[model samples]
Target: MATRQKIALVTGANRGLGLEIARQLGKRQMTVLLGARNAAAGEAAAAGLVAEGIDASAILLDITDGASVSTAVQTVTEKFGYLDILVNNAGILPKLTEEGSPSQASPQLLLDYLQTNFLAQVSVTQVFLPLLKHSTAGRIVNMSSSIGSVTIASEPLHQNGPKPPRLPYAASKAALNMFTVLLAKELRPEGIKVNSADPGLTQTDAGGPNAPYTVEQGARPAVWLACLDDDGPTGCFFTHVDEHVVNNPW
Candidate 1:
C-alpha cells in the first residue's frame, strides 16, 4: 500500500506565529488547513500559501466555540480521511482592568484567559482525537510560553519576575503544560505524540512590534514538534531558541 499523505490543522493561522507554522508545514509537502475564526482572513492566508505551491486551504474554526469546532471537524473529515497533526495555537491576553497583575486581576479576567487558552485546547483535542487516531504517526503540538514557567515566575531577580506577572496568561499556559503531560501519557499506548512548544518572546501583535524575535524564528519549534518521528519525546516543554536541542522541560 502507498503511504498516506499527511494533513495538518493549525489554529489562529490567519497571522502571526500560527501563519508561519502553516507555511513551514506546507513546505514539507503536507496538506495544510489554515484555521481562522474570520472567513476573509483565513481565505487570504490559505491563498498566500497556495501561491507558494502548497496544498493549503482555509477552514473556519473558532476554537472557543463548540459549534465552530464541530463544523471544522466535519469539514476536514469530508475532505481528508485523517489528520496527522494538530497545533493548538489560538490564544489571547485579556486587556481588562487589572489584567497583567495577579494581585489585582478579577476572577472574571482569569476565567477569560482559561477559556481561550486552556479550555479551548481541551475541547479541540477531544473533538479531533478520533481523526488523529486514524493516522499512522499522529502528533499534537500545543503552543505554550516561557512566561508560563513557574520556576522563572518565582525568581525575583529574573527579568520576567520583576515585571508585573501576566497572571492569567501565564497560569493558563502552566495548565496547558499539565495537559500535555497527562494527554501524552494516555495516548502513548496508541503511538501519538503530544507536546508543548514555547515560542519564547516573539513579536506578534500581542507581543508588540518591538519584541525581539521575528515570527519565523519563533515558529520553528512548533513546526519541529509537529513533524516529530515516532521515536521523538512526548509530553515535554521546548523552545525555538536552539534547533539542535529539544524538550528542555519547563
Candidate 2:
C-alpha cells in the first residue's frame, strides 16, 4: 500500500501565528486545513495557501462550541479519513485590565480564559483522538505562552523578560501545559506525541505590532513540534525563543 499523506488541522488559522504555522506545514507538502470560527475567513486563508501551490482547505470550527467541534470532526472524517497533526492554537486573552493581578482578577475572568484556552483544547483533543490514532504518526501541539511558566512567573524577569503577569491567560495556559504532559504519557505507546509550544512574544495583534519576533519566527516552535520524528521527545514544553534548547517544566 502507498504511504498515506499527512493531514494537519490548525485552529484560528485565519490570521497571525496560526496562519503562519499552517503555511509552513503546507510548504512541507502536507494537506493543511485551516480551522476558523468564521467560514469566510477560513476559506480566504485556505485560498491564499492554495494560491501558493499548497494543498489546503477550510474547516469552520469553533473550539469553544461542542456542536461546532463535532461538525468539524465529521467534515475531517468525510474529507480526509484521518488526521496526522492537530495544533490547538485558537484561544482568547481577555483584556489585561480585566485581569489586573492574580489577587484582583475576578473568578469570572479566570473562568472565561480557562474555557477557551485550557478546557476547549482538551475537548477538541478528545474529539479528534480517534482520527489521530488512525495515522501512523500522530502529533498534538498546544500553543502556549511563556507567562504560563510557573518557574519564570516566580522570577523577577519572567520568560517574556519584563512583563506583568497575565493572571487569567497565564493560569489557563499553565493548565494546558499540564494537559499536554498527562495526555502525552497516555498516548506514548500508541506512537503519538503531545507537547506544548510557547511562541513567546510575537508580532500579532495580541502580541502587539512592536513585539520583537515576527509571526514566521513565532510559529516555528509549533511547526517543529507538529512535525517531530518518531524518536523525537514528547510530554515536554518548548519555546520558540530557545527553539527546543530548553524544555520548560511547570
Candidate 3:
C-alpha cells in the first residue's frame, strides 16, 4: 500500500505568515487545511494555492469560538483521518496608542488578546491532539513572538530600545510560550514534538508596514518546527532567521 500523505492544519491562514507556512507545506506535498475566520478569505487563499498546484483546502475557524474549533476538528478528522502537524498561528495584538504605550489598554482588550493568543491555542491543541497521536511523526508549532521572551523584556538593552506600547500582546505570547513548554513535557513521552516559534518583525497586517521581514521569512521557522524529526528538540523556542533556540524566561 502507498504511504499516506501528511496532513497539516494552519490557523489564521488566510494571509500573512500563516498563509506562507501553509504554502510551504503544500509545496512539500502535504495536504494543508487553511483555517481562517472569514469564509471568503479562506476560500480565496486556498484557491490561490490550488492554482499554484498545491493540495490545499480552507476551513472556517475562529479560534475564539468553541463551536468553530470543534467543527474544524470534526471536518479534518472526517477528511484526513489523522493530523500530522498543527500550526497555531491565530493571534491578535491589541491596538497601540500613538505614543506606543499600552497604558490605555482596557481589561476587555487584554482579555480578548488572551482569549485568542493563549486560551484558544490551548483549546485547539487539545481538540486535535488525538489525531496528532495517530501520526507516526507528530508536530505542534505555536506562533510566539520575541517580545514574549521575558529575558528580552527584562534586558537593559531591549528596555532602552523602543519599548512596545501594547503590553497585552507581549503578555499573551509569553503565556503561549508557557503553554508550549508544558505541553511538550506532557506529550514528549509519546514521541510528539511541540515547540514555539518567533517569526520576527515581519511585514504583515499585524506586524505593521514598517516591519523589516516579509511573510515568507516569518513562516520559515514555523515550518521548520512543524516538520521536525522524531529526535528533534521539544519544548524549545526558536526564531526563523537565526534558527536558534531563544532563552525565554518561561
Candidate 4:
C-alpha cells in the first residue's frame, strides 16, 4: 500500500505571495489547491506549478462570497476526502482615499475590511473544518502581519518607522490573529494546530519592488507553519526574520 499525499488549500493563490505559497507547498509533494476568484488566472497558476513538476490544481473560490466558498468546500470534499493544511492568504490593504488615521476612517470602510479579512476567514475555517477534522493531523495557517499586532500599533514608531495609514487592514489582521489563538485552543483536543504567520515586508505584487525581501522569504513563515509536524507549537504568532522564527507579542 502507498501513503496518501497530504492536501493543502491556499486561498487567493492566483498570484503574489499566495501563488508562491502554493508553489512551495506543491514542491513539498502535497497536492496544492490554488483558490482564486478568477477561474482563468487560477488555472494558469496551477498550470505553471504543474510545469514545475508539482501536483497542483486550481479551485474557484472567493472568500468574500458565501456561495463561492460553500461550493469550494463541497468541491474539496468530493475531490479530496480530507484537507491537511489550509492557508488563509486572501486579504486586502486599502489605502486612504481621504485624509485621516483610524479615528478618521469611516465606519463603513472599517466594516468592509473586517468582512473580507476577518469575518470571511473565520467563516471559511468553520465551513472547511469538517474536512480538516477528517485528517489525522490538521494545520491552519492564517496569514497575518506585524502591523496587526496591537502592541506594535501602540508603538510610537512601528517596525522602526511611522505606521502605514491602513488602519482597517491592521485591525482586520488583529482579529485574524485572535481567531488563530482561540481556534488553536478549541482544536487542541482534536490535535489540530492553528497559528498565525506574518511575512514581513517582502517583494510581492502587494509588497512592491521597494520592499526589502523576496516573495520566497515572505512565504517561508506560512510554509513552515503549514508543514509543522506533530508536537509543533500552536496558538502562537510568529514571523520569519533572518531565517529564524521570531515570536510576535499579541
Candidate 5:
C-alpha cells in the first residue's frame, strides 16, 4: 500500500533555505504550502515547484501581520482539514553598525527583528495548534540557530570560537528555542512533537557569502525533524550534520 500524503507549510518559502525545504518535501510527495510575504514571489516560487510536478501552492504570510497569518491558517485548514507539519522558518537580521554591536543597534531594527523572528512565530504556531492537533503525527519545526545557545555565549573559552556577535538575532533565536521546549512539553500528551532546528551557517542572505554550508546543508536538520518517527526526541536543539542535541558549550 502507498503511504498517505502528508501536508506541510513552510513560512518564507519564496527563496533560500525555506524554498529548498519546500522543494525537498514536495519531492517526497507531500503537499506543500509556500508562505511568503510577497504575493508575486510566492506565486512564482509555487509555479517553479509545480513545474517540477509537485503539489505546491502559495499563501500570503507576513509573520508580523496577524491578519495575514489568520487568513493563511483558515485557507489551509479549509483546503486540507489539517496540517501535518509546520516549518517556522521566517526570520530577520538587522544590519550591524561599524561597531558591530547590539548596543548600537537601532530600536526600530531590534523591534522588527523581535516581531518577525520571535513574536510572529509564536503567534502563528499558537493559531495553528488546533489544526496540528488534528494530525495523526503532528510535527512543529522551529528554525533556530547555534548562536542561540546561552551556554556557548557565556563561555569565555569559546569566545574566540566560531560564534560571531549577533545579539538581537541570537537573542530572538534563543527565545524561539525556549518556546519550542515549552510547547513540546505542553503538547506531548497530545502526541505532538515540537523541536528546534539549527541549519548551521549556510550560504543564504542571512548566512552571508562567507558561509561554508549550502542551503541543502542548512535544511537537513529541519527536514529530519519534520519526518521524525513516533519515538523521536522533542524539545531539543539539533544541528544539520548530526541529530545530536546541542548543549551549552560551557
Candidate 6:
C-alpha cells in the first residue's frame, strides 16, 4: 500500500508568519491546508503556494466562528481523511493607549483576547482532534509568544519582559501554554505531540517592522515541532532560532 502524505492545517495562513509556516511545511512534502478568514485571500494564498509546486488548498476557517470551524473540519475530513499537523496561529493584538497598564486594561479587552487567542484554539483543537488522532503521529503546535512567559515577563532584563504591559495578549498565551501542557499529557498515550512554540519577535505584520527576525526565522520553530519524529519532546516551550533551547518562564 502507498503511504499517504501528511496533512497540515495552519490557521491565519493568508499572510505573514502563518503563511511562511505553511510554505515551509509544504516544502517538506506535507499537503498544507491554509486556513484564512477571508475567502478570496485564502484562495490567493493557496494559489501562490500551488504556483510554487506545493500541494496546498485553501480552507475558509474563521477561528472565531463556530460554523466556519465546523465547515473546515468537514472539508478537511472529506479531502484528507486525517490531519497530521495543526498550527494554531490565529491571534489578535489588542491596541493599547499611551502606556497602558494591566490594572487599567478594560474587562472587555481581556475577554476579547481570551475569546480569540485562547478559547478559539481550544475549540479548534477539540474539533480537529479526532482526525489528528487518526494519524500515527499527530503534532499540534501552538503559536505562542515569549511575552506570555511568566518568568520572562517577571524578569526586568528580558526584551519581552514586563517593562511594558501587554496584559491581554500575554495572559492569553500563558493560558495557551497551560493548554499545551495539559493536552500533551492527555494525548501522550496516543503518540500525539502537543507543544507551544515561541517564534520570537519576528518582523511580521503582527510584530511590526522594528522586530529583528524575519518571517522565515520565526516560522522555523513551529515547523520543527510539526515535523518531529516519535522521540521528540512534547508539552514544552521552545524557540526555532535558538539551538536546543527550551523557553523558560512558561
Highest TM-score among the candidates is held by which one? Answer: 4
lDDT of every model, 2 decimals: 0.89, 0.91, 0.88, 0.91, 0.86, 0.90
How well is each residue in 1-250 modelled by candidate 4, as lDDT tens digits? 8877899999999998999999999999899999999999999999999999999999999999999999999999999889999999998866546425766878888899899999999999999999999988899999999878998777767645755466788889999999999999999999999999999998877787998879999999999999999989999998976978788877
Candidate 3 per-residue lDDT, tens place, 1-250, comes to 8888999999999998899999999998999999999999999999999999999999999998999999999998888789999999988765556223567667777787788899999999999999999998899999998888888787898777766655778889999999999999999999899999988899898789999888877888898888888778999998854655343344
* Model 1 residue 138 distance off true place after TM-score fit, in angstroms: 0.5
Candidate 2 lDDT at 124 equals: 98
**Residues 124-180, candidate 6, lDDT per residue (tens digit)?**
999999999999899999999987899877676864554568888899999999999
Whichever of 3 and 6 has more lDDT, that candidate is 6
lDDT of 6 at 234: 90
For candidate 4, list the clashing residue pairs, or say none.
none
| Candidate 1 residue pairs that clash | none
Higher lDDT: candidate 2 or 6? 2
TM-score of 3: 0.93
List candidate 6 stretches off by more than 4 Å: 96-99, 158-162, 242-246
TM-score of every candidate relative to the true structure = 0.95, 0.95, 0.93, 0.96, 0.91, 0.95
lDDT of 1 by residue, 1-250 (tens): 9888999999999999999999999999999999999999999999999999999999999999999999999998888879999999988854444564667766887898889999999999999999999999999999998778787666766554446667888889989989999999999999999999988778888777887888888898899999999899898888865554355546
* Clashing residue pairs for model 6: none
Q: Please give, for residues 110-222, the per-residue lDDT of candidate 5 as tens digits.
A: 66667888999999999998899889999999998877888867778657775347777877888999999999999999989999988888888877889888888789888
Q: List the candidate numbers ranked by lDDT, top first.
A: 4, 2, 6, 1, 3, 5
**Which residue runs of candidate 1 sit more than 4 Å off their true CA positions?**
94-100, 159-161, 242-245
Better of 1 and 4 by TM-score: 4
Better of 4 and 5 by lDDT: 4
TM-score, cand. 1 vs. native: 0.95
